[model samples]
Every structure is written in structure tokens, then in C-alpha cells.
Target: MHRIVIAFLLSSLSGLAFAHGMSAEDQARILNAGLLEYMQLGATHMLSGYDHLLFLFGVVFFLTRFKDILKFITAFTVGHSITLIVATLLEISANYYLIDAVIALTVCYKAFDNLDGFKRYFQMSSPNLTWMVFAFGLIHGFGLSTRLQQLPLGTDGLVLKILSFNVGVELGQIVALSIMLVILAGWRKTASFERFSKASNIGLMLFGGLLLLMQLHGYQHTQFPDEFPLNTDDHFHIHEDMEAETSPLTNYPNKLNFDDIYSQDEVLHDDNSYQDEHSHDGEDFHSH
Candidate 1:
């Protein structure tokens, strides 16, 4: 059972660390799509969003009580929903890679907390779990907002569309959480669960670290592209070379000028015709 949990977490994180948001076609669909379509996009995004799922799993890892789950999830939802709406509406946005980097860290943070890293490493107590989760949710919402902003959301019926999308995200969350809870419940019944709980959370922390590194690397590439070993300068030089090589004048500099050559031919033809006419007149005069 614990084996299943570890495998599931690892596989999900591995996928999440590299997954992109939506495709161009999906973004195009959002341009003229209705509320239901937007809703579907939101639902699909959440369902496929491994980073979000892992963090959520970390959040509910030890919470056996239904009320606690409700409280924590609600706090998280409210926090993210506010920013998702407000940020997109007010046009408040940030670099998504950076936002995602922080989001990845949240997974690490939750996993570390789950394993009591603070007590073990620093001999300190953690903060209020509810408030911290809410805070992290705010950050998560900003990430969501960045994705929504990529869509061509027009002025008309924008609020309704955002609301619908939020609803869909919640729906997706519910479905995912249900499955996770069932898995956890089953694992709890097994005797090995207690033995492996620490290891599982440790695994979660490792996954989070990988995600964090990926996000930071992405951020670095976006911010300082030239720092990478791959020669981007070559790309620019190749473009310039192509432009120069493809120029008409550059390719045929030694070729004769067609306009000038045609003008010269016409002038020579006129001169020959005038000489021939005069010669014909002379011949007629001599014959007479």
C-alpha cells in the first residue's frame, strides 16, 4: 500500500515538473469560447496540474478528519480564487516561471513540514498550518492567473467566464482529492503504513526539490538566456547570413542590368533603321 503511494507520488511529480499549461489551439478556443468551454479548460488544467496536486496531497497527508480537510481546502481555495480573479481582472501579472518556482517550493515546504523537518533540523515549531496554507494558496492563485491571462479573454462576459473557470477548477480539485483520500484511507489500514510514512514524506520532499530546480532553471533561461553554454549568438548570426545570402542584388551582382541593356538595344535598332532608310533613298536617287 505504501509502495503504491510512493509510486503514485513520484510518477505524478515527475509528470508535473515538466508539463506545459495549454496548447495554442486551446488558447485560440478561449478567444471565442463560451463559459462552459472556459470551465472545461480550467477543470482540465487542474486535473493535469501535477504541481498543484502534489502540494494538495502534502496538505492533506496527515489530516484524517473531514472537517480539517474542509477547513484547509477552503482556505486554500479562497486564497487562490481571490488572486486568480483579481490578478486577471486588474491585469496584475508576474513572471509565470518565477511564480511556478515558488509554487514548487510550496510542495517542498509542505512535504518538509509533513516530516517535521523544522523540529528535526532546527529544533523549532512550524507556523499555523491553516494560515500558511492560505498564504501559499494566494501564491498558487497568481500562477493560475498567469495561465488565464494567456487566453484571449475579451471584455464582454469576462467576469462570468472567470467565475465559471474557477468553478471548474474547484470541481477538478474535488475529484482529485476524492481519489487521493481513498488511496490514503486504504494505505492507512495496512500495518506497513506507519513504517513507511516518514519515507513517503521524504520522497515527497525530494520530488519537490526536483520541481524547484526545474522551475529555477527555466527562470534562469528566461531571464539570462546568454548565460547558457548553447551559442545563441550563432542563431542571430545565421539569421543575418541568411538575409544577406538571399538578397537579389547580392546573389546576382555581376549580372547585366536588364533595363539598361534593353534601352541600349532599342537605341541601336533605331540608329540602324535610320541608316537603312537613308541608304534606300540614295539607291533610288542613283537609279533615277
Candidate 2:
């Protein structure tokens, strides 16, 4: 049991690195990709999205009836699909890191709800689960939209492209939920599940917190690169090396070469020098 728990934690942590970022190869390929190719990319994104999967897991963890499952899932599906399509079509955008951070919170929210944390700690009933799930689903879809916008989604057939991708996302969700339901149904028959359900939800919450911190860390690095001791170029290289070492599940023949993406001169400017160059109202404008 201990080994199984350890393995699950390790697997979840490893998945954090590969959560829904497009590689250079992906960007290049999508330049002329057809609807089917777009569908494939969407499915791939959903499958690789660990935060999304974790939230879904928490949503279905307590659902025993097929009708209940169907109702909740349909709500989530409609919610996400609405944002994914509309956001992509309108080119609505936000920082992907920040969006992912909120998605992480959604994961934490679901787990907390599952464990009845509100009632236990606050002596109050939780919000309506189905409505909350739907709201979180909207946020999750926006997260997906942020990633989708990274691709070269041409304007010629943009609507079709978005719809195709949304379809793929649904297909991927169906596959993932099918697997989750099967595992949960089988586990429900065992005594261990009753013994361990609370522990599992707690673990889910911990994982979500970890992901939240990681996303915020990434946001800081990207948005405030000059604040770090190492320049952005060096930091990116360190990340590249770390990814190479840690991610055994993925094979990146065409690894993301940040050299093509980041300009060293632009990112390597000293903070003091930058402050010296720019001032606001006769005072140094310092970044905090």
C-alpha cells in the first residue's frame, strides 16, 4: 500500500512537466495542419494535461450512478466547450501560467469538496457541487484556449479548427472518464477503498497545492526574468537540462531550443542598470 501510494505521487509529480505546452515541432506542424490533425493535437493535449485529469478524477470519485455521472460530466463538458470555442474564436488571451494556476486551484477545490472540508472545518455546507464543477469547467476551458492560441491557427478555417479541437477534447475526456469509472467501480468493491478514500483526497489536495506553487514560480521567472541571479537564457537552459533528466516518459528528438526563442541581450540586462535607464517622477522605478 505504501509503495503504491509513493508510486502514485511520483507519477503525478512527473506529469507536471508535460502539462499542455506545445513544442517547437508542434508549432511548425500546425502551420498547415488539417482538421484531423487539429483534432489529434487537441486529444493529445487533453491526455497529457495532468491538472485537468486530476480535477476530473475528483469530480467522479464519489459518483456511483451512471445517470449522475452522465449529468455531471455533461455539465462540465458544456461549460468547457463554451469557453474553448468562444475564446479561441475571439482570440481572447491570458497568461498561460496564471491560467494554469487557477486550474490547479480547481483541482484543489474538487478534492477539498470531496473530503467535505467545509463541513468538517467551517461547520457549513459546501456550495452546490454540480454548479461549482461547471464554473471550474469554464476556467479549465480558458486554460485550454490559452494553449490552443499558441498554435498557428490560421484564420481561413479557424472555426472549423476550433470545433475539431473541441471534438477531440470530448473524445479524450470520454476515454479518461471511462478508465476512471472502471477503476473506481472496481475499487468501490474493496474494503481498502473505504479505508483510504480520505487519504487519497488529501493526497490530491497536496498535489494540487504543489502544482499551484510550481505555476506561480514559473510566472515569476517568465514575467520578472531580470530579478533572478541567472539570466533568462541560463534559466531556460537549466530547465531544459532538468527536463531532459527527469522526463523519462517523453522522448523529445526535437527538444525545445530556447536559443531560438529568447534573446540573451534582452534578458541579461542587470536590474540596477535597468533602473538607472528608466525613472518615474524623478524616482527610481523599482520592480518588487
Candidate 3:
């Protein structure tokens, strides 16, 4: 069940490989200048990152208790923060796809654990899952920081900018978590919670699987997304002058009424002398 959900999500994400975001070079330019850009990076990274948000959604879904949520989230936060800072400051790097692939697996692992699949399917011991979660988080953090580093960073105030951006990421996560909690709590009040809940878990599993495969696809092509969904096209071009169907352009083909593309004077003056007749008729019409 969770697998199905994961599949759909990953399908959507698989487009990530081809789905354009800030290029590493472009991101470096943004990273180098202005506090505004730095702050925006934090917000943008969180906003644009589907994988991060999906994992976060999985993390918070089952947590109804505040203390428990705080505890686990704090651990995850600490893990990410440590690496994000260290990675950016120390300039350590790793392959993006592998890290992202692991991150996708983290989503799968967490969702599966939440579903208690291990206890049911394998009858095997899965110990210290939180620790595992934290470790994976470090990997995810490194992936993000590496992307940030790809942007050119002048030695001037680099540390401060990265710190500020990371802070923004934390803030964005908090906001996202709060919203998810509010929505999930509201949903729990309804009767469908039990009936559809397993299905939802299945969805998460599927999303994770797709992301994992999608990342793998990118590794194969360097254009891999972190999830699955075979895509047709992400962008389109338009030419206003041509008809969309026959002309192979984006615009409607008005019948070759070249006269329509004329100046006011040209339009008013015709070889048939209709313009002269119309002008004479206009004065009469006005008088009437």
C-alpha cells in the first residue's frame, strides 16, 4: 500500500533529473551576493525540494504527541545542521545522486518503519532506527550544502550567509511541520482515518521507491529525477505568428487576412474605394 503511494510520488519526482532548478553555476552566483539572496536560498531550497518535504511529511504524519515529535525532529534537525554547516564551511563534497538516492531510501525506510513492515514481514530486529534516520539526514544535509557550495562564495561573510540560510531552512521546516500537523490532526477526527490510512502509508512507500529509482535513473544519465513518473515534456515553445495545428506554432492562424496586420491609414484606404464610400457614409451616419 505504502509502495503504491511512493510510486506515484516518485513518478512525479523522476522528472527532477530533467526538471530544471537553479543550475549549480547559477546557484553559486546567487550564493555569493546579498543577504536577501542568501535568505531566499534557504526558503527556495526548502520550497523547491520535493524530496525534503516528502520525507518531512512522512516524519510528522504519525506523530500526534508534541514531545515525541519535538524529540525526533530535534534529532533530525541537529543531524542536518551539523553536516550542512560542516559541509559548506569545510567544503566537503560527495556525489549528488548517491546522496539523494540514500535520502529517498530514508523516506522509504521511515515510511516502512511507520507501517511496521519490518516486524510483520521479516520478523527481523530493526534497532536504533532513529540513529539511522539521523545518519541519513546528515547525508541529505550534505547533498543540499554541496549544491549551495556549487554557487560561488567569496571568502567575505561566507560563513554567516550559509548559517543564515540554514536557519531559514529550519524555519521553513517548522512552518511545514506545523501545517502538516494541523491538517493531519483535523483528518484524524474523521472516520475515514482508519480505512484510508493504510492506503496513505502505501502511498509514501511508493513515493520513496520512485524517488530511489528516479535518482538511480539520473545516475545513469545525469538527468535523473529522485522519483518516478515518465514524463512527456516539461516545457513548450510558442510562435504567435503561426497556427497551433497547421503552422506548428503556438498561435491561432487567422486566415491570411494580411490586411488585418496593416496600419490604420492602410486599413481605411482600399483599392476598391470602399474606404472613400465608408468615409462619406460615416459623416451621414454621424449626422443622423
Residue 165 CA displacement from its true place in model 3, Å: 1.3
TM-score (all chains, Cα) for each model: 0.78, 0.78, 0.69
Backbone clashes in model 1, listed as residue pairs? none
lDDT by residue for model 2 over 143-251, one digit each (tens)?
Answer: 9999999988878988999999999999888887887777787778878888888988899999999999999999998899778779779899999989988997567
lDDT of each: 0.88, 0.86, 0.72
Superposed by TM-score, candidate 3 places the C-alpha of residue 140 at a distance from the truth, in angstroms, of 1.6
Tens-place lDDT digits, model 3, residues 74-192: 87888888899998999898768777888888888878877888889999777685787688778778877877776777788988888887887887788767766776777777776
lDDT of 3 at 12: 43
Candidates in descending lDDT order: 1, 2, 3
> How many residue pairs clash in all the candidates, one count each?
0, 0, 24
What lDDT is reached at residue 230 by model 2?
90
* Ranking 1 against 2 by lDDT, winner: 1
